[model samples]
Each structure stands twice: as C-alpha cells, then as structure tokens.
Target: MESVKLFGTWFSPYSRRVEMALKLKGVEYEYIEEDLKNKSPDLLKYNPVHKKVPLLIHNGKPISESLLILEYIDETWPGPAILPSDPYERSMARFWAKFLDEKCPPAMTRACMRTGEEQEKAYEEAIEVLTFLENELIGKKFFGGDTIGLVDITANLIAHWHRFFEEFSEIMQPPLITKEKFPNICEWVNDYTNCSFVQENLPEKDKLAQLYKARIQAAKAATQ
Candidate 1:
C-alpha cells in the first residue's frame, strides 16, 4: 500500500486546497495538523526552506507549496481531473492560478490591514487585480467552466478567506471586495462555496472570523 501523509493547518486556505484535491481524487491521506506558531519536526524536515504547513509526503518523498502539491496530486492519482487535459487550457489554468497567488493576496491584505494613503492605494490595486478575475468569470459558472478545477481551488483564498478580514476588521473601510463592484466574482463565490466537496473541506466560517478578528486586534495593538 502506498503511504500518503499531509501536514497542514485547519484554517489555512492553502492547506484546505490540498485536502480538497485529495478528497476529489478519492485518495485517502493521513492528515497531520500543524501549529503555525510551533511547527512539527517532520514539517521542518520535509519543507526545511519554508518551514510551513501544507506539505505533502508520498511514499517518503515530500512536496512543498500548495499549488505544486495540487499538480502533483492531479498527476499521481487516478480520479476526476483537477487540471484540464489540453495543453493550452492547462497552461491558462496555471497562468490564472499564478496570477492569483502573486497579485491578489498582498494587495487585498494591505487594503484591509493598512491605513490612510497606503490603504487607499492597496484598495485600488486590489480592485484592479480583481477586475481580471471578474472578467474571466463572465459567461462561465466556474473558472474551470463546469466543474471546479485548479483555478477554482486556488481561488479559495479570495472566495472564502478574504471575507473574514472584511467582516472582522474595522480598518477595512470602504471595503475592497463588494457585490456592486464585482458581480461576477460574487456569483462565482456563491457557486464555489456551495459545491458539496468545497463545503466539506472548508473551516467553519464563524471560527475563522474569530481568528481573523484576533489577528486584526493584534495588528492594531502593535501599531499603537
């Protein structure tokens, strides 16, 4: 029997994406939850450079980074496809995923967490970045068209996690993400979160909200 183990955290969208992929592939894996404050020894051993969660260990070989882990899962497992088969479509999916990871999160975080001029700049930047995704979703139910695919999974941070910051932080004035501004993204969030597999893998929203609230409080405390 092949040995599969995953080191991840409950609240991390990165970790959840991997779990969603594994479950989608019907690949049973031993899940080891890691405390981000004090990570496990095996996690350090496997992902020495980053020393982060969402590390995948398969038959003694280790893989770091969530997107890479998702690709690995798609290639190694025999199940419903996580990435599109066609080379062009697959490349496009990877492109969008990379764009999301590289461009969206930092701007969105700064928009919510920073103040005054910095926050305004980040908010505008976030709107600009999100416009691309909003346009991409036009006339499509999912980024993957019908079924959830790599882009959809990678978007979990935007679809789900970002909401908590808006909900829990008072500093997020004027709001970076809104239904009026990005209707297509709103619909996509609805569709993505409503999916059964996604629902099963997501952390409880209330709990996540509290975590964000505490983190926001800590950030404010530090700034003062």
Candidate 2:
C-alpha cells in the first residue's frame, strides 16, 4: 500500500476542501492537524516555502496548494471525477476556480471587516465578482453541471464560510450574499452544503463562526 498523509488545520476552508477531495476519492490517509500559532516541524520541512497546511504527502513526495492537490488526487485515484473530461470544459472549470480563489475571498473579507468607504468599495467589487459566478450557474445544478466538480469543490469558501461571516457581521455590515441578490448562488449553497459527503468534511458552523468572529474583532481592533 502506498503511503498517503495530509497535514491540515480543521477550520481552514482550503484544508477542508482537500479533505473532501480525498474522501471523495475514497483514499485513506493519515491526517495531521497543524496549529497555525506554533508551526509544526513536519509541515515546515515539507512546505518550506509557504509552510502552510493542506499539504499532501503521497508516497513521501509533498504537494502543496489545495487546487493542485485536488488535481493530483483526481489524476492519481480512481473515483468520482473532479474536473471535466473535455479540454474546454476542464479549462473553464480551472478558470472559475482561479477566479474564485483570486477574487472572492479578499473582497469578501474587506466587505465584512472594513468600515465606511473601504467597505463600500469592497462590497461593490465583491458583488461584481459574485455576479459573474451567479451567471455561471444559470441553468446548472452544480458548477460541474449535475455533480460536484473542481469549481464546486473550490467554492467551499463561498458556499460554507461566507454564510457564517455574514451572520457574524450582520451588526457591523450588510450581508454580501443573499437570496435576494444571488438566488442561483443561494440555491447552489443549499445543494452543495446538503451533500452528505460535503457535510462530513465541513467544519462545524458554530465553531467556524466563533473563529471568524474573533478574526473580525481582531481586524477591527487593528484598524482602530
């Protein structure tokens, strides 16, 4: 049997996505939890440059970056397909995943954490970015059409984490995502989070909310 191990923190969306992919592939591996405050030696050694969690060690070779790790898992294992088979569709999947990772999180964070003008600017940018995503799901059940795929997996942040951030920030800021503004996305969130496999891998919402609440408080304190 091949040696497979994953180093990740429980509350990280990136880490959780990787775990979801591994479980989807039915790949049994060791999971090592990392404390972000104090670095782990093995994590540092394997991912010297980033020294980040969600690092995959397969047969002793390390793969960093959650998306790359997901692709690796799909290609290496025989199970449900993560990306599309067609070249164009696969490229589009990758495109949207990149867009989400690059565009959404920073804007969402600023929208929730910043105040006044900065928050307004971030909110507009986030809406624009999310509009693009909403249009992408026009007639589809998932980013992968009917089943979970690369884009769907990568969107765990938006579907899961963003909701909690909105709940915790409602007093300080308006919600970035809502049924009124993004119905398609709202439905997608319902579908994605309801999946039994996805649920099993998700961090508990209450715990995640507490973490985000602390982070939001910290960010506000820094700005003040």
Candidate 3:
C-alpha cells in the first residue's frame, strides 16, 4: 500500500469533503493541518498551483483540488465506490458537483457576509441554489441514492457547513432549510450527519463558530 498524506484545515468544507471521501473509502492517511494565513513549505511545494489545503500526497505525488482528489481516491481504492458505475448517472453526479462548486460559495458568502441590499440579493440567490438542490433531493435519502457517494460528498457543504454558517453568522438571515420548507434536504442532513464516519470526522461546531465569527469581523473591518 502506498503512503498517503492529506494536507488540510479543520474548518474548511473543501478539506472536509476530501476527508469524508478518504474516511468512507477506509483509507488510512497522515493528516497535516495547514494554516491558510501562514502556509507551510510542504503545502507550498506540493500544490504550488493553487497552494490550497486538502491536497492528497500519495507515494510522494501531490493531487490538488478537493473534487479531483475525491475522484482520484475513488479510483485508487476499490474498497467502497464513491461514484456510480453507470455512465449517465456518473455524469449527472459530476454535473451536480460542478454546479454546487461553482454557484454555492459565492451565494452563501453574499448571504452570510454582506448586509442590506447586497445580503438580500445573495439571500435570494442562495435560496434558488438550495431550491434546486431540494428538488434534486426529492425521494432520495442521499444525493448518490441510498448510500453516501460522490454527490453526497460534494453536497456535504450544503448539509453541514452551510447550516453552520447560517446558525453562527448574525449577518445571515433566518434558516432556509427547515423541515417544513425543505423536508428532503432536512432528512438528508440528518442521514448524512448520523453516519458514523461523518460523525467521527465532522469539525466541531463550537470551533467552526469561532472561526466564522472571526471571518465576519475581518470582512467588516476591511470595509470600514
């Protein structure tokens, strides 16, 4: 077995996605936490292109980007398949992953970090994105079906981190994913978080709250 090392941070949703993929695949790896404010030499050397966390170093070779790393992990380890075998389904999974990656962060950032009209616009956009996901989640316990797979891994941000941000950030509006409004998403969140692997690797809520609080403060400071 080749040695695997993961460079990541505790509160990063991208890093957590990679961590969940590794844990679900039952891959044992050495986890090195990176300080985004002061990145380490190894992280810089390995992922010079993006210099981002969640870089997977396998047998001394580095893989960057969380989504690509998840795909690589699924391919490298056959123990538990994260992606569907069917070609069309696989494509759909990839499509949604890409959609969320491109659209989610900005909308969520707008909703949580900005205020007044900027926040209202972001809130609406964020709701649209979540609405699309809520529709996709209808009649499915997990985005990848019964078991948590590639789509679920990618969607983990919606299930966990997004909820946490809404909860902790005073700038964010009221909860958008309540059971009455988005039953499927709420159910999926419960199922995803209840999974033993997810429970074990999920970032502590209190720590994440503190981190996000500092971020909100920093963003406010930048404008004033």
Candidate 4:
C-alpha cells in the first residue's frame, strides 16, 4: 500500500469534509496541520493552484480540491461508498456539493463584514440556501436519502459552521434550523456528531465559536 498524507487546517470546514470521508472509509493516513496564512512550501508545491489545505497526497501523487480529492478517495478505496451508486443520484449529489462550495462562504463573509442593508441581504441569501437544505430533508434522513452520503457530509459541515456564524454574525437572522424548528436535521446532526469517528476527530465546537467571533471582528475592523 502506498503512503497517504493529508494537509489540512483544523478550523476549515473544507478540511473537515475530507477528514470525515477518510474516517468513514477507514483509510489510514498521516495528517499534516498547516498554518494557512503562512502556508508551508510542501502545501504550496502540492496545491500550487489553490495553495489550500485539505490536499491529499497518495504515494507520490498529489490531489487538490476537497471534492475532487474525496471522489478520488472513494474511487481508490472501494468500501463504504461516499457517493450514490445510481447515476442520476450521483449527479444530484455532485450538484449539491458544487452548490455548497460555491455559495456558503460568501454568505458567511457578507454577514461578517457589513451591517444594516448588506447584513440583512446576506442573511436572506443564507436562509434561502439553508431552506433548500431543510426542505430536502422532509422525508429523507440524509441529503442523498436515508444513507449518509456525499451531499449530507458536504452540507452538514456548513450547518456546523453556522453555529459559529450565529455568534460571529450577531446580525444574522437564520431561518428555522434548530432541534425544535427542524427536527430531522437536528437529529441528523446529532447522529453524525455521535458517530465515533466524527466524535473522535473534527474540531471542538467551543473553540470554533471563539475563533469565529475573533475572526468576524477582524473582518469588521478591516473593512471599516
């Protein structure tokens, strides 16, 4: 077996996505924590295009982009599949993942940087995205249906970050997503968090809250 190594930052949800997938599939690999602001030469060389963490290096080959690396990991390791087996279902899963990577961070960024009109607009947009997710869970336990697959992992990590955004973006008026408001997703979060691998790995929520609060304040100060 070739050696597998992962470069990631603890706070990034993008990094967490790959972490969850690897654990779920029971892949053994070494993790290299990177200081993204002061990126290492190795990370820069491996992911020169993005210069981002969550780069997966298998044997002598390097794969960048979280979703692409995830698909590669799934392809390489054929146990406990992350994507759907059916072609149509797989397309839907990819669609949701793409939507998430494209849309989510900006919503959080907009909410953090401005207030009044801008902040409200950001909140509205964020809720629309969250609403799509909440409604998608009407009958299905997970995003790609009953089994926890790619889409579920992609979106739930955002919902996790929303916990931080709530405090960081005090102006945020998030739509119904709590245990009382959206019971299925609430239970889904609990289920995912309770899974031994997720429980053992992933960032601690309390620390995330503090980091987000400070980071939001920094963004606010920078823009002002």
Candidate 5:
C-alpha cells in the first residue's frame, strides 16, 4: 500500500470526515496538523488553488477538498466502502452529498457567526436545509438506510457541530435538532456518533467549542 498522509486542523468537520473515512476503512496514515491562521508551505504547494486543510497526500500525490478526498479514499482502499456498491444507490448518495455540500455550510456558518436579525435569517435558512434532510431521513435509521454511507458522512456537521452552534450563537429559536422535531435525523446522529471509529477519532468538545468561539468573535469583529 502507498503511504497516506492527511493535512488537517483538529476542529474542522471537513478534516474529520476524511479521518472517519480512513478509520472506517482501517487504513493507517500519517496525520499532520495544520494551523489555518498560518498555513504551511506544503499545504499551499499541494493545494494552491484552494489552499485548504484536509488535503490527502497519497504516495506523494496530493488530493484536496474533503468530498473528493473521501471518494478517493473509498476507491483506493475499497473495504467497508463509504459509498454504496449499487450504481443507482451510489448516484443517489452522490446527489444528496453534493446537495448538502452546497447548502449546509453557508447556512450553518452564518447561524454560528451572527447574533441579530442576520442570525435569525441564517437560522431560517438552516432550518429549511435541515428540514429537507429530516424528511428524507424519515423511516430510515441512517441516510444510507441501515449503514452509514456518503450522505450520512456529508451530514456529519449536523450530527456533531450543530449543538455547538446552538450553545454559542445568541439567536436560538428552534433549538438544535431535537427528536420531537426531526426524529430520524436525531436518531441518525446517535447512531453515527456511537460508531466506535467515530467515537475514537472525535476531538474534545470543550476545545472545539473554545476554538469556534474565538472564530465567531473574530468574524464579528471583522464586520464592525
């Protein structure tokens, strides 16, 4: 097997998603922590276009972007596939994963950063996105049915980071996804987080919260 290396920050969901995929596949890899504030030359050299963390370097070849890296890992390693085997199921998984990739980040990022009317608008937008996911998850234990798959992986932010948003953000209305309101999604969160690999790989919540709090303060300062 070729050498695998991941450049990522501890607190990033994108990085965690890749880490989980590699763990699920039982692939051994080197983990390199990158500071987003002062990015290293390797990160810039490997992913000059995006200049982002979670870049997977395989056999000295670098792959950037979390979703794309996940696909690469799934293809390269192949055991306990993160994506389904059936072509149609794989297509559906890809669709929803891409949808969430486009939709979830902006809505939730805003919800995390702003505290006033702007935060309300972001919460509304996030609700719409989560509601769509909630309905899709109806009658299903996981987004990929019985087992966690691509869509489930893509929705990792909701399962883990969202609660922190509720705790940190001032404009809390609906309250971070509850079983009463989004039963399937709530159930999915439990199932996903309880998975042994995910449990083992997750970062400490207190540290993550503190990191995010500083980020939110910085974002607020930039606006003022």
Candidate 6:
C-alpha cells in the first residue's frame, strides 16, 4: 500500500471528520499537523485553491475537502463503508451530509461571531438547521439507521465540540447537545462516545473548548 498522510490542524471539526472516517475504515496514515498561518509548501501545492487544512495525500496524490476525501478513502479501502449500499438510502445519507457541510457549519460559524440583532438572526438560522437533524433522528438510531454511517460521520461535531458553541455563543441559545434537552441524542452519545474508534481518537474536551473559543474570537476579529 502507498503511504497515506493527513494534513490537518488540531482544532478543525472538518479535519476531525476525515480522521474519524479514516479510523472507522481502519486505514493507517501519517498525521501531519499543519500551521495554517504558514501552510507547508506541500499543502499549498496540493490544495492551492482553498489552501486549507484537512488535505489527504495518498501515493503523492492529494485530496482536498473533508467529504471528498472521506468518499475517496471509503471507495479505495472498501471496508466498514461509511456510505450506505442501498441506492435510496445512500442518496438520503448524502443529502443530509451535504446539508451539514453547506448549511449547518456556516450557520454555526456565523452564530459564533454575531452579537445583538445579528446574533439573534444567526440563532434562528442555527435552530432551523438543527431541527432537520432532530427530525431526521425521529425513527432512526443513527442518521444511516441502526449503525453509524455517512451522515453520522458528517454530524460528528455534536459528539465532542458542541459544548463550546453553547458556552461561548450568547445569541445562538439552543441547548441542543444537553441531555435533558435532547434525550435521544444524549442517549446516543453514550454509545457514540464509547465506540472504540471514536473514544480512542477524540481530543480532550476542555482543551478543545479553549481552542474553539480562541478560533471563534480570532475569526470574529479578522472579519471585524
């Protein structure tokens, strides 16, 4: 097998998604922590367009974007597939995953930076997107049904970094990740957190929270 190297930052939820997929697929790879401010020449050459973290290099070929890299990994390894086999179900999983990638993330990032009126608007948007997740979980244990699958991997943010948003964002006031507020999600957390791959790879919550807080502040400052 050719060498696989993951170029990522420590605190990016996007990078974590790829890492989780790689773990679930049982693929071994070198983990390279990148300095985003001063990206490695290899990273820039590999992903010149976005020039962002979470770039996966395989056999000297580079894959950019977390979701794309995930699909690539699954396609190549062909074990513990994150995506579903059934056509319709596969489409549904892709739909939800794309929704998270396109909508939920930007909404959360906006909520993190907004204050007063802007924050209120962002709060409404965030809740609206979160409602889809709640509704999607209605009859299914996981987004892909009984076992964790594609959309489940995409939605991994709720597992670890959710608290940082709830704690730091004054305007986006949904306590969705809390046990009392979301019993099923909370219940799911017990199994999700204990899963061997997830448990082993997850970063410490307190440390991650501090990093998340700092990133939010930095993003806010850069935009202002």
| Winner by TM-score | 1
Model 5 agreement with the true structure over 78-145: per-residue lDDT tens digits: 67878889999889999999989899888877766667798888888888988999989888988989
Please identify model 4 stretches exceeding 4 Å from their true place. 174-176, 179-181
Q: Candidate order by lDDT, highest to lowest?
A: 1, 2, 3, 5, 6, 4
Residues 1-224, model 6: lDDT tens digits? 67999999877778888888899988899999999888999998999999998999999999998889888988899678788888888788789899988988778667766778997787678778877777788777787778878787777777667667667655455553556656666666676778888777677788887887887777667877
Model 5 misplacement above 4 A: 115-117, 221-224
TM-score of each: 0.97, 0.97, 0.95, 0.91, 0.92, 0.89
Root-mean-square deviation of every model: 0.9, 1.1, 1.4, 2.0, 1.7, 2.3
Model 2, span 93-118: residue lDDT tens: 99999999999999887787767788
Clashes of each: 0, 0, 0, 0, 0, 0
lDDT tens digits, residues 1-224, model 1? 89999999999999999999999999999999999888888999999999997999999999999999999999999998999999999999999999999998898998888889998888889999999999999999999998899999999999899988877778877776779998999999999999888999999988998899999999989999
lDDT agreement of model 1 with the native: 0.93
- TM-score ranking from best candidate downward: 1, 2, 3, 5, 4, 6
TM-score of 2: 0.97
lDDT of each: 0.93, 0.91, 0.87, 0.78, 0.86, 0.80
Model 5 weakest 10-residue run by lDDT: 165-174
Residue 220 lDDT, candidate 1, scale 0-100: 88
Candidate 5 overall Cα lDDT vs. reference? Answer: 0.86
| Model 2 misplaced stretches (Cα beyond 4 Å) | 170-173
Q: Which one wins by lDDT: 3 or 4?
A: 3
lDDT of 4 at 50: 83
Count residue pairs with overlapping backbones in model 5: 0
